[model samples]
Target: MAQREAFAGIMLENENMTIAPGAAEDDRLDYFVHKDGLTFAGTHLIIDLWGGEGLNDADLIETTLRRAIDVAGATLLHFHIHAFEPDGLSGVAVLAESHISFHSWPERDYMALDIFMCGKTDPYKAIPILREAFKPETLQLNEIKRGIVS
Candidate 1:
């Protein structure tokens, strides 16, 4: 009997593996399924927020991040926030699975966020919390899957 599997862009046939045509070598193992056969390592969300409100308050930022963590069903280990000079905020929520972080420029009404979570956590669930907290006029989001393939 022969078995085949496709991981990222590479094809595994029995004991032989080959990269799919036009697939970059570096992209070969960007995503893969775990041994349990039901989960990947994690999901990474890169978000750009524009014309948002409350981007300067460090307290609000921390609270919102906590809410996001809860909404995503992730476990929080610790979190920290810094209020920038004049008007801005930066923070990170460290989770057992991974982390959620952001940098905000209140003067420009812009914010950038990275939310990465692994091990059964659904990072996409945090989007609604972010929308309610920031109320951004424009939102740009990108999702990437990260893991190892064997």
Candidate 2:
């Protein structure tokens, strides 16, 4: 007996199910196959901000986070911010979708930020908020998709 799996007009037998180099495009499997068709899971943004001002202010950090949550279309649950010994701030904004967090190094004029959101929220929308708040001369950004789909 032979087992078979079919996807996007491509049929595969258990013994010879290898995918050819261009099979995905030919069969259109990329269109229909995903983690789950029903959910997008979420997006995580890792941001590095450099040469920014006001990085040490806890009040400013918290306010910026609040604005970021609003811009990202994520619901805020709670928030906490702490100022460091000399001149730094750490903050977290808990959201219904996920969270946004940051740690600042005022001495170097740098800040590390994380923004994670799920569901229908658009995490990328927070970029403008961060830019306006930090005024970074240089920025590095990385995006990652999160969640497991069956």
Candidate 3:
């Protein structure tokens, strides 16, 4: 069985594995990006989809997220989703660069999303894919360059 660790109401489950001496592992500095004389940790995008379709469809949402992740050049580590009691859902895709997460309210035809990526990954590339898949009537987007260094 895998081991579970808990902190602040959040739990992380990990599989049992042994490391080889010569194995390549734990490299994160390579994930940072440098652009236009500035170095930053990642690009974070806040997206809101109002009056959208298929927000309640878990399979379509997952497929769309996978397609967006692939198109954005981000490596997906794991993906998980949960459906609510009535008509809502939430999901997260943990990626090598960062993560893409969202919560949907099907009754309201709305969705909130956060897409963040680091290193050589382009988070903006996911926008079009998401827009096409969700088909929102009103879309709002904002961007932040996280961990900037002068």
Candidate 4:
């Protein structure tokens, strides 16, 4: 299926969403990521999934959140999700780096997500994992670099 992928500050289609062959599965994050010649706090990503599949599935949402956290090398402190009447859910996975929060509108096949991580851990690494899991027809992302001290 054709899908959109967005991260950092760029947008690409399926081409950018694939986990490259021979890619290292684990990242050795011994320190926080320093950005642009400064002491950077972290990266924050705002993600939107339109026309996505399984937006109403709370179980799938929780599972995907866990998987994304692992792939991004973030530490999970706590996880909670609440499914609502009709068809929708809101959840969050608290992480040492930050958090990944989810709010789904199954009525419109849309999902919104927030991913933020501190240190050398690669927040960018989680994008593809989410693309593969949600299979959204259109994906949009915006990135913000948090806490930079020159």
**TM-score of every model?**
0.72, 0.72, 0.82, 0.76
Considering TM-score, which of the candidate structures 1 and 3 is the better prediction for this target?
3
Worst 10 residues of 3 by lDDT: 1-10
Report the C-alpha lDDT of model 4 over 6-96, residue by residue, as the tens digit: 3333433495254333314465443456766867667889999999888998888888888888888888999999889988999889887
- Expressed as tens digits, the lDDT of each residue in 19-63 for candidate 2 is 433244454322211333543457789999999978887777888
Ranking by lDDT: 3, 4, 1, 2
Ordering by TM-score: 3, 4, 1, 2
Q: What is the lDDT of residue 120 in candidate 4?
A: 56
- Candidate 4 yields a Cα-based lDDT of 0.81
Residue runs of model 3 more than 4 Å from their true location after superposition: 1-26
Expressed as tens digits, the lDDT of each residue in 84-130 for candidate 3 is 98889999999989899999998888999999999888888898998
State the displacement of the C-alpha of residue 50, model 4, in Å, after optimal TM-score superposition: 0.4
Backbone Cα, N, C clashes tallied per candidate: 0, 0, 0, 4
RMSD of 4: 15.6
Candidate 4: give the clashing pairs: 32-119, 32-120, 33-119, 33-120
List where candidate 4 sits over 4 angstroms from the true fold.
Answer: 1-32
Best by lDDT: 3
- Please give the CA lDDT of all the candidate structures: 0.80, 0.78, 0.88, 0.81
Candidate 4's TM-score reads: 0.76
